[model samples]
Target: MRKITLSNGDTVEVECLSCALTSGLIESDGGVVIETDYLHAHQAVAYRIE
Candidate 1:
C-alpha cells in the first residue's frame, strides 16, 4: 500500500497491481471522490479517508 499526496493536498492510497495499474481509494478533505484505474485495478482496495 502507498499514499500519494496530490498538489492540492488530496491523498490517494494505492497498490501496484501490474505495470501501469494500481488499486486504492481517493481521500480528499474537500469532499470529492476521484476515481481512476491509476489507483484501483484488479479489484484491489488500498485506500481510506475518514
Candidate 2:
C-alpha cells in the first residue's frame, strides 16, 4: 500500500495498482472513494475507512 496526506490533513492509503483507478477525498471521519469507469459505470458507494 501507498500513503498520502491530503491538504486537509487526512491520510489515505491506496493499493498500488488501484491507485490509478481511484480518486479520493477526506470526509468527517473517513474519506470517499471515486471509482474509475472500469470499476463502475454509474456512481457507486464511496468507500470509507476508519
Using TM-score as the measure, the top candidate is 2
Best lDDT among the predictions, by candidate number: 2
Give RMSD (Å) of candidate 2 vs. truth.
8.8
After TM-score superposition, what is the CA distance of residue 16 in candidate 2 from its true location, in Å?
5.5
What's the count of clashing pairs in each model shown? 0, 0
Q: Candidate 2 residues 1-50, lDDT tens each?
A: 76755444656675642343243332323333444555523222233334
Point out where model 2 deviates above 4 Å.
16-50
TM-score of candidate 2 relative to the true fold:
0.31
User: TM-score for every candidate vs. truth?
Assistant: 0.29, 0.31
Model 2: residue 45 alpha-carbon error in angstroms: 20
State the C-alpha lDDT per candidate.
0.40, 0.41
